[model samples]
Target: MDASELDIVDRPAASARGWRVPLLAFARNPAGSIYGTVVADSVLAVESERQTKLSDLIYAELITVIVYWFAHVYADFLGSPPSGSRRASLHRLAVTLGHEWSLVTASFFPLAAVLLAAAAGASIQTAALAGMWTGVAALVLWGQLAGRRAGRGAVVSFAYGMTAGLFGLALILLRVLLH
Candidate 1:
């Protein structure tokens, strides 16, 4: 669903409860987060296997996310009905980019986890693992939020969380199998 489809009442209530409303709203439409987490995790897995430097791994993951974000924005803008004029087209492009900004922001937590772990003197491989796990945790949290937002019960929400987490696990498994 697009941003317009979000439940307007939910945002205000979540904000009143001291929840991070933007993050929760993003969770309510988790395609970007899921895409970002998968991409970041896959990068971490591959870089770790190569024993890449922490800096290089971080750069690679960041660049990858930005590139993918731009690609998504471009595709979305192109797919949308064309505006009448050049200025209007540019404005539409900007709006599409803004709408898709979550794709880049969603990688923040996982990347931060890598940075923090590396700063704490963890090996590059260990830090990458931390990042991967952070991505998995984020996916699970997003899934739970989505399920609850959809009015699902606790058990169903938990199941949703598990289903989302399995994506991360599958990536990890692929890394293992490759190496």
Candidate 2:
């Protein structure tokens, strides 16, 4: 059949929910947390000579998260600005940059939660667990939303959510094992 003779699929207008693209982009950008955990755990494990406190471990991990987050943000900022003749007003530019930067920043929230919990005198182990779960939950929710947007059924969407969570967790496990 000639290309023009094929029927078009009725679909969503791309401009609608345009914000979702960036929101998903922000949600998906946090691989560094795993890397940070591994690095922090390994360094603290080796350097302390004695056992490190749970608070200390989580704090160190949080620092690593921030460092990796910073690198990611800086790199993105360099690549994020609009190119060529496309120009935005100062306010638009500010908003664009803020949204772009959020992609890198969102990953830190989980670790920040851990930090706050620890500061409040919670056990590092417990706080870390909560933080990790928070991140995983975010991933799963994002996945579910994504699947729904793609017209998946409820079961399929739930499965997609678990898949996203498990995939991220697997990467985290791999980093932990390797480090």
Candidate 3:
């Protein structure tokens, strides 16, 4: 079957009875639950290393942003615990990790593209073009995913910008403090 014609069904749906659907849904949607786990890991990595590069820092921030959007999307689509409830707090924390992961994933594409272009001795214009296209494409993909799952593309865009800003700030602070 042609790739476009192949109806990709999640196999886990078969066994997803009762609470399994919610759990598996969260698991499968990287933006949903998986994002939280990824952020926690990145944070821990930074904490353990005691230092990080600008690129790495931006990457972490971006991931956190995506993760936040994911959590927002999930909570919005599938009712969440009442705001400020213990359960809600816990869920938010987990979702935070997932956002971090998504942001990091998003950042990696652009960074890698730019670096590869530079290494190849491409012109400055070519490097910038590669980075810009890669970054935009990644964000668009994420936004489309967000739209499908949450009915909001703005959330994805917001997260992208917010993550970059926050992470960039943190990195600057860290550099100043450590330097």
Among the numbered candidates, top lDDT falls to 1
Task: Sort every candidate by TM-score, greatest first.
Answer: 1, 2, 3
Q: Write the per-residue lDDT of candidate 1 for residues 55-144, one digit (tens) a residue.
A: 788888899999998998888887889789999999988877776777777788789999999999999888888988998998897677
Report the candidate with higher lDDT, 1 versus 2.
Answer: 1
Q: Which of 1 and 3 is the better model by TM-score?
A: 1
Candidate 3 lDDT over residue span 56-83, tens digit each: 5345545665666666666553565466
For model 2, how does the per-residue alpha-carbon lDDT over 1-179 read when each residue is reduced to its tens digit?
A: 65544423212443466876565555442333333333333333332333247646645655655565567556654666555544544455555445444333545655576667778886655565556656566667666766776789999989877876775576456545654
Which regions of candidate 2 are displaced past 4 Å? 1-96, 175-179
lDDT of 3: 0.48
* Rank order (by lDDT, best first): 1, 2, 3
On a 0 to 1 TM-score scale, where does candidate 1 land against the true structure?
0.83
